[model samples]
Target: MSTNVLPLSKPVPADSSLRLVPDVPDFVVGPGLSPEVADVVTLIGGSATAGRNLAETRRIFTQVRRALGPTVPDIASIREEVINTPAGKLNLRLYRPSFGFRPLPALLFFHGGGWTVGDLDSHDTLCRQLAIATGHVIVAVDYRLAPENPWPAPIEDGWEALRWLSNYAPLLAIDPLAIGVAGDSAGGNIAAVLALKARDEGGPALKGQVLIYPCTDLSASLPSHFAHADGYLLTRKQYLAYVANYLAGQDVEQDWRVSPLRAARFDGLPPTVIITAGFDPLLDEGRAYAGRLAAAGVPVIHRSYADMVHGFITMGGRLPAANRAIADIGRALASHDIYAFSDGGGI
Candidate 1:
């Protein structure tokens, strides 16, 4: 580990309010962040979504995610399928584990790119790894992206995919009863919403939900939004831009469907595994969401990677913790005995 402390510079876009370390005079690098990630941060500099319009931002994001993503591991089998929804054709990729039993438990994964950029290919490697680690089938949903198919469109696609998967579980040898939802970032937001929706609809009961550094609150007023906003890969400017693009000029920040943290109740939701990054902007809200779920009597397991940042889960190639986190998430998804664990706070 490098004992070297990098100096902080003013954030790009001339935003004086954005602080790398809130209320702290001296800004040091790798406070708790691993040296591997810190070196990558220095190499990458700032957000790829910075200073670009929607089209360019999307292109850059796609490129960066692919280039920095972990090495793809070979899985048992991968097949593509399409579900015809009222909105349109929703594409999905199913990954079967090499060693899981017949009718294996499955996880429906949503890719993260703020809801604007990512697609099936962006998260292909991660899903493959998840399937292998958990010994469960992994269904990767290639939902519609934003600024094109904005709010509720991705959700609609996600919900329809779940329904379709449940209805046709036998076709793919999936255990309908053992189905769960998992996603990172914006996809995490969708997974959280879908868990609630499934509970309310009273069918297709989910086994669990894995939320990886999810942006639970669109309000974006949490303290972490400013505390670790600038130096990390995900900048505040980019975060708001993603939200705006998803909203598509609509004022729906308070909508529970858009922000699951705003939901009136969290009870009866599936057992949840919430992964939070200490240096990510969404840290506070992710913790708050876990607390809310626990308070409502839902079984929740909250894991905080105190040295990581937002979107670190996708950069497993550059950071060893990301790969370890993926395996940890796999155990959470695979375990049926997860309710035995506490939410750490005993809330």
Candidate 2:
């Protein structure tokens, strides 16, 4: 990995799609968020590359969660239970908006913790914001973390969750047709793979898929790995280290679930939205996936946040530009009629 950090001010298109959040206003983020979360985030961000292997990585991440405390969002309803699946029991948290729910679009969310850490608690605010902004039923999937469960475990949980969601629609009060999958970083990898799996297997098709600064490739050869390898929040050394543990001698570089960019066929996938952070280490791969989706004739809309770093979407409620993304997703959902689509009907 290169020691140089790509300056956020580097040349890019002059459109509003490019964003940098720390430069934006402070209102997007609200009060009530504990300061302890900030300190914990810094610790994990710094700990990114310190883990010698998966075991050590899991130990450090467990410590990080202890430091971060728990979810503090008012609207976020944290359900800490295990859902029985064909593969095994998986953990999940379902976040419902303040609005009364008859039936609404459901977004199965995967929290980003490098596939090592992160749970429903860590992503409380983001899920609340998504529920409010998109007016949808957001079910955040708390799949077993890596090194503990590894690649196929997380991937299998994700796919089963989707099937379970479809199979148990009445229990969830979700419009089966209006269902979609979303996540950031490692979660995004799951979302991309889920979208592909549904299309290939003739499973319940998603209305739309949202990927926020997704890590689409695991080979560690993308340019952003070197271009923004240091001092930009997400370091390349930290990235490779996390994957090394999460993968742990598993062959994931070619697995479509681990690296959605490697999927051979992309046609017939749902209309999609791809969000990219300009200074993010995964920028190139995210954009490339969007391009591939477009090339494959999938209706796709791509946005590049020029000034933001990786994980800005999770911070949208705090930064002005991030708030815009929240609203953008809402409007897109409105068009998709996320609440109205049903598998038996049209999604």
Residue range with the least summed lDDT across 10 consecutive positions in model 2: 1-10
Using all chains and alpha carbons, the TM-scores for the candidates as numbered come to 0.85, 0.78
TM-score of structure candidate 1? 0.85
**Candidate 1 on 203-308: residue-level lDDT in tens?**
6778788898998999899999998777776778779988987999888889888999999999999888999998999999899999999999988888899888
Candidate 2 residue lDDT tens string, 135-241: 66678887887666787888888888888888876666667777888988888888999999999989787888888888899887889878777645577777887
Steric clash count of candidate 1: 0
Q: Please report, in order, the local distance difference test score of every candidate based on alpha carbons.
A: 0.78, 0.69
Candidate 1's C-alpha runs over 4 A off are: 1-32, 50-55, 99-101, 334-347
Candidate 2 positional error at 164, Å: 1.0
- Off-target runs (Cα >4 Å) in candidate 2 are 1-47, 52-73, 76-81, 98-101, 316-318, 335-347
